[model samples]
Target: MKILFLSLVKVNSLSDRGIYTDLLREFVSQGHHVTAVTPVERRDSNSAKIEVEKGFTNLHVRTLNIQKTNFIEKGLGMLLIGRQFLRAINSNLSGEKFDVILYSTPPITLYSTVRKLKHSMNSHTYLLLKDIFPQNAIDMKMMKKDGILHKYFKSIERKLYNISDHIGCMSPANVNFIKEYHKYVSTDKIHVNPNSIEPIIQTISSKDRELIRADYELPLDKSILVYGGNLGIPQGIDFLIEILENVKLENVHYLIVGSGSEYQKLKNWCDQNKSDHVTLLKFLPKEKYDKLLSSCDIGLILLNKNFLIPNFPSRLLSYLEMGLPVLSATDPNTDIGDILEYNKCGKKVLAGDVISFKTALNELLSSSSKYQEYSNNAKKLLLQDYDVVNSVQIIVDRVEQVKFNQNV
Candidate 1:
């Protein structure tokens, strides 16, 4: 099958590991010809071009910087990105036809582009519902609910859903949210297709862990609780600071390694309350980050308590891949905490509940036997539920089913 994947993530090569790249690699391994259309943001100073590689082609469309920029630019960039992508596709791949059009939510501005391609190539469109928009924006208080911008994006969201032949949500909670709010969407079209990756299975030796921790100035004797991802508003940064301010455990340490809009805020707090227990660092490269993550004893996840949308962060896969038990402080709406508890891989507490968070942390840190059990369960859960092969198979099955229905 000829597959076209649309995403905001910049993928320079399939050799790099990430959820989207891993999924695309799986498609290539399954004998599918994949064309991934991705952005080359203005900050990168790259021109639009197409690179043909083994098993797939990557079309890089130049656009305004949509990530880690001011709100005006990000908003404008998303608004204009779809048109930019369509023009690039027509110019470079005019002769190409796609069997399946697979795209993920983020911008949600690809409605016109997807509609045009689906009609032109007679392709089946699949929506990888990673982030629910407008609502999330409202949740962050970035956009006012029922305001002009919200109403505008809401219409686009509906159009995007309407054009999609299938919508693959990240979890059961997401599927339920969509079903309840978007009653016009058919239930048959929605299914759980989680954030998956081709997990690299390896363990850092005790010596290596100690070395890595020493390199980062992290104490080897303490149980390191690491939060290694975007430090943005959606992550409930205030609550994380609260935990740091109040946590008095001598055997526990906090390691935060990421850069985002909220990085400065967290840095300011860390500066004011300088302590030996907490270490804050900027984002590291993937290889280095993974090594640092493996050196840590626990993985941390945080979400803003106000979110109505269930956001399943892809960072969970990284933590699980390393066999580190997760500790999530998230909004009540997301089921990430539920999954962690059900699999016995970790624990979760409501965001802003510092007491519960500390208690769970103590439980995970108190018993070595229980920690090992949770660690083992983490790896098992990754293999059974979050593997990229499963995601690839689910998409292929859905595409085939769509084909059969069209024929019937």
Candidate 2:
């Protein structure tokens, strides 16, 4: 099958280890031709280019920088990005026809493009619902519910959902949330197709872990709780810092390694506190980051307490792949914590509940046997459920079913 994958992220290689790249690689491995349309957001210039890679073709459309920048600029860029992307696709791949169209969210501006592709090529459209946007924006107080911008984006969101033949949500909570609030979307159309990856099971020797810890200035004697991902508003950085400030666990060290809009805020708090128990570092290269991750004892997941939208973080897969037990501090609405608890691989604390967060950390530190059990469970669950191969099969099966129904 000829598959067209569209996303806002710039994916240069299918060889790279990411949610999209891993999934697309599986499609290629299954004898399907996958072409991805991504953005190459530039600050100084505006241009688009296409690159032919080994397993797939990448069409990089130049647009305004929308990530890690000022909110106003990103907002304007997002507003115009859909039109820019549609033009780029029509210009370059006008002759190409795809059997299926797959895309993910953040821009939610691709409704027109997907509609055009689905109509022109007679293709089935699948939406990988990674985000629920305007609501999330409202949760973070970035946008107001009755505001003009909010209403406009909500319309785009609805159109995107309406055009999708199938929508794959991250978890059951997401499925429920979408089905309940988005009554316009059929519940049968939404299924749990989580953030999956082609697992790279790399084991770390004890001595190697020690060496890496020493090199990275990480404490060898302490049980390290590492949070390695975007440190933005949605993550509830203030709550993360609050937990950090209140955590009195002497044996458990905190290692935060990521950069985003809230990096400076966290950095300021770290500098002012001048505590040796916490280490705040900028994002590292994948190899080094993975090494550091393997050296940690526990993985930390954070979400804003005000969230009405449930977020399923992809970072959970990374921690599970490394056999590290997760400890998520998230909003009450998110079901990631529930999933973790059900898998018996982690514990969850409500976001902003510093006391619970600290108690959970202490409990994990107190019981080595419990830690080992959780770690093993995490790895086992990843192998059983979150593999990209399984996710790819699910997506392909859905597409085939959609096609069959269309024929019937």
Candidate 3:
């Protein structure tokens, strides 16, 4: 099968370790031809180009910077990206007829390009629904409900959903949300296909851990709770700051590593407070970050209390990969906490609840036996629920079902 993958994520190489790259590599490994179309942001000063490797091809389309930019530029870039992608696809991949048109969301503006390709090639379309739009924007107070921009994007969202042959949601909650809110979308078309990765078996020796900690100047005696990912609005930066301000734990250290729109907010607080227990650093390279993560004892996840949409951050995989127990402070809508608690892998507290957050942290810290159990379970959860092989099978099974139906 020849697969066309449309995404906003920059895929410079298929060898990189990420959810998308891992999935694409699995598709190729399964004897499927994969062509991934992604953006090369204007900030990079790179022109559009295509690279064909062994069993995979990548088309890098030149576009305005859509990530790590101001709202005005991000919005304009998203709105214009569909047409830009379509033009590039036509110009370069005109002769290619895809068997499957697979794409993910963050930008719902790709409806035009998806529609065009699906019609042109008569391909089975699959939506890897990563982010719920317009509604998520409204939840963050980034856009007003019933406003012109909201309605416009909402329309695009619906069109995108309607055209997709199947929608793979991140969790059961996401499936329920889509079915409850969008009555027109059939339940049979939506299934839980989570953010998955090819697990890297990482084992750090005691000496290696100490070396990594010493190199980064991290305290060796303190129990480090690291939060590694985007420091954005969705993370509810205010609540995170409140936790830092109020927490009185002497033995527990907080290490925050990531860059986003709200990074300055975190940096400002860190500078003003000058707390010895807290360490704030900019985003590090993946190889370096993984080593740093392995040195930590716990992984922290923070989400805004206002979100009505259930967001399952891919960062959870990183924590699980390192066999670190997770402490997620997120909205009640997401089931990430439920998964953790059920698997005995981690604890979850409702976002903005400082007391509960502190209590959960203490529970994990106080019990050495419980912490070890959670650490063991974390790796189990990753292998059982979030391996890339499961995600590949889900997608391939769906495509096979479609082929059988058409032939019948």
Cα miss at 215, model 3 (Å)? 1.0
Write model 2 residue lDDT over 281-339, tens digit each, in one string: 99998878888899999999999899999999999999999999899999899999898
What is the lDDT for 144 in model 2?
A: 85
Residue pairs with backbone overlap in model 1:
none
Global Cα lDDT for candidate 3: 0.94
Clashing pairs in 2: none
Indicate the TM-score of model 3: 0.99
Q: How do the candidates rank by lDDT, highest first?
A: 3, 1, 2
Better of 1 and 2 by lDDT: 1
Prediction 2 TM-score vs. true = 0.97
Clash pairs (backbone) in predicted model 3: none
TM-score of each: 0.99, 0.97, 0.99
